[model samples]
Target: MSSFDLTEDQQDCLQELINVAMGQASDQLARYLDTFVYLKVPSIEQVKSEHLFETLNQDLKATAVVSQGFFGYEGIRGEALLMYQPQDSHRLADLLGYEADELTFDEQIIDLSSILTTTFLNVFASQIDNQMSYSAPRLLSANQGTISEHLNQQSFNWDLALKVRISYQVTDYSFNCDMVLLIPEEAINNIKAVIDRILEDF
Candidate 1:
């Protein structure tokens, strides 16, 4: 893997941390919605940042998007994105406690993405034992091409990114969304080191 100086064992250990982070995200959603939230098993992948949209296109349509950039005191930094198709929008709207047709579809997407991204950042920052802060998330045009296209357009040519994707559904309703966390390759080594330290402590 292009995980900087991380070893195979360290990679496995790093995933354990991600599992915990996912759980935290799940719990937050369940409590906020006051319903059971089922998070599918998450998978980790190492790929060029440019390949993100193409790779995820098979499973994600990304008709809507919310993107946020984050950074921490220890120098670990990157962005988090939440994307879903129009068909999946109503489900997400309901999960946010809105009637399917109540809010402007774009409004619902913004609300949903903001909630998920904040929860993710909290758990992730806590796990890595760093003080990470986020910039105000800017809503983007859904008409924009694939998510990868947006990233490329931004001129952020990342060589590699570690992607952890989890699909979640609200058990009480037919609502589900895919959450993808992208950590740059440069941050992976620092993240691995942090997770390793946590494992050693326990």
Candidate 2:
């Protein structure tokens, strides 16, 4: 039996896998917006549940909302989240050719948002899964308030967190999206075990 802590190589692999996933996410966004999308590598930061708001505030000055859930293979599960400043949502909707103010919580927008979120999760998860040789990914959406709501939670198991941020410029409008990864503490041990097995075999 091996200790749960991840080896240095495992950490590097996780980061590399996340980078690939984020790159795929950015490409998908570019295709959807029909314009180049500027992206930054996801970062891992230690944050206190109480200070979540402050942390989110540092990256964005407006009301920050988040949508989160877990997705991945049978055992090698991965968590996912989408967060952004509330104001950015309006610009993002507009980039998709939607009038933010005109659109209400109608099923159409809700359904569309679900679809968009699913696509983003799928693309990102698929890339990471490929790199790790994991099973197909699964996606879940939070029915909470907004993006900020879930992210601000006092506690959520995320032993490994990766955040991919995007800033888009379409015409005069600016769009922002943050793709976050959250893995439960248990999964950290599982992932480390998987890495150890691989290392032993080689």
Candidate 3:
């Protein structure tokens, strides 16, 4: 097994926790949007920092990115990133009961991003029984860079990433959202320690 690789049993337990968080987020979104929200079988990967784009997600792009960092005395620290199509900002605004005019577009994107990120992020931390706190979410537009690039710029040398993707369909339009938790190379041991505890509880 590689440094970032998880045993089959660990992967199973992690996927279950991820599924719960994703399902809860979907339910909240369904009620918020008044539309059906669907989740596919979630996945977790131990991807190298360099191969982030190719090995992890082929559709990764330079678009809307919202992220928050989590940490506490519990030694749990990681970043949550959400990426979506910039074009969907307008539709999202309308869904949230606002028009996406020039003046409101930025605020609309930020608000939508915050709602989606916080909902599931909190769930992930709680399900792990780790008292993690999150910093205010940060948003990057298309001009800033791809999400991977942004992570690199943040001086984050993530050796592995745990990615979960969920989709939402509203009538004729369909949207795909990618959410990931990136772990630094040095933090891998610390994280797997937590995962071990989670597995023991299972």
Best by lDDT: 1
Model 1: how far is 94 from its true place, Å? 3.8
For each candidate, C-alpha RMSD in Å? Answer: 2.7, 6.0, 3.2
Query: What local distance difference test score does each model get?
Result: 0.72, 0.50, 0.65
The TM-score values for the models, in the order shown, are 0.82, 0.62, 0.79
Report the lDDT tens digits of candidate 3 across residue range 1-94.
6766778887777778878988888788778877766666656666666677664346656467777777744566777666776655447666
Q: lDDT by residue for model 2 over 90-115, one digit each (tens)? A: 45555665666666523223433444
Candidate 2 to truth, TM: 0.62
Q: Which residue runs does candidate 2 get wrong by more than 4 Å?
A: 1-5, 45-61, 99-102, 105-117, 128-172, 194-202
Judged by whole-model lDDT over C-alpha atoms, candidate 2 comes out at 0.50
Cα error, residue 55 of model 2, in Å, equals 4.1
**TM-score-based ranking, best first?**
1, 3, 2
